[model samples]
Target: MDRVKLITIPKIEDTRGNLAVIEKESIPFEIKRVYYLYDVPTGAYRGAHAHKEQSEFLIALSGSFEVVLDDGIETRRIMLNKPNIGLFIPTMMWRELDNFSSGSVCLVLASDTFDESDYIREYDKFKLFKST
Candidate 1:
């Protein structure tokens, strides 16, 4: 399976800069939840897990970061810095986030509610589970 998918957010350019918008019906799925991660200390990492059924879109609202994604057989890396673009993560893909710039903000939009049971946190376990 492919690891990460990039969705081109529709951006309306302006004299000031640019603006991007995300609507529930416009995406592949409805937006059921929203969250963000920020204030990450230097040399630290986040999001070492995979979701079973939830799909998500991640945007770099500020600064920059790297999103590393892995399926059972393949892996991919994406650099997110622009607020107008988003990385779409499908279900059952393992992901790890790192290389965060100072004051970086990672915003995530989910298709499901907060459910710990939908997450696979261990890489080995995820690989094994995907095989079955």
Candidate 2:
């Protein structure tokens, strides 16, 4: 729902270890910022907001987690458990991260810099904005 997709990044395998690579050409948008979430307590949640124009790609670097996506019309849950897999999130959708396993590291690649004005933090307000 809401055009969310699971993307596979290029992975290089070797005897030493495995490597995953991500570039602007491999993703749908140019990455402008990068951040991560880690050390979250069990049963806790994060990212309960929606962006007006920003988009993001989320990757599970160390452990597993679930992403809850809502578009004001439908909802879907996506699991991120591998370093080479990413979840691409488009604009105008609400996202929440939860069900994180211990030692989970959530890496996010964003298409824009941090802009407070672009965020819609309330669910009812987001629905109204989506209708208009």
Candidate 3:
């Protein structure tokens, strides 16, 4: 919803493999947690929630997928495919992942550890919370 920053991480290409690294302070926030979503069936969606404090960077590692971001009042869609690019989601922005390709892998980097209180899972509740 609010202006989120999307950064494209540079990929180091090699004869054997490619690598992309994220160091502390390299991004807007420090790295506190990491997670990935995989084995998601086609037409299935994920991540219909918003965070209170956590900032996230999402990457499509294997296949292409669409990330729908809503900032309560407005919405935007982002297409992710390359491993070197990542979407930086600011706090309080609602997000949803959809149009996942087969064998798609979505990786997420977080700025905070798991805290139940930071999550706002309901859209209406998130809208109300953001307005205040």
The lDDT values for all models are 0.89, 0.94, 0.90
* Model 2 error, position 62 (Å): 0.8
lDDT tens per residue, model 2, 1-132: 647889999999999999899976778999999999999999999999999999999999989999999999999988999999999999999999999999999999999999999999999999999999
User: Clashing pairs in model 1?
Assistant: none
Per-model TM against the reference:
0.94, 0.98, 0.93
Model 3 C-alpha lDDT versus the unseen true structure: 0.90
Single out the weakest 10-residue window by summed lDDT for candidate 1: 1-10
**Per-residue CA lDDT of candidate 1, range 51-106, in tens?**
99999899999999999888878788889998878998999988999999999999
Q: How far out, in Å, is residue 96 in model 3? A: 0.6
Q: What is the lDDT of residue 77 in candidate 3?
A: 95
The candidates, ranked best first by TM-score, are 2, 1, 3
When sorted by lDDT, best at the front, the candidate numbers are 2, 3, 1
Model 3: what TM-score?
A: 0.93
Selected candidate, larger TM-score, 2 vs 3: 2
Number of backbone collisions per candidate, in order? 0, 0, 1
Better of 1 and 2 by lDDT: 2
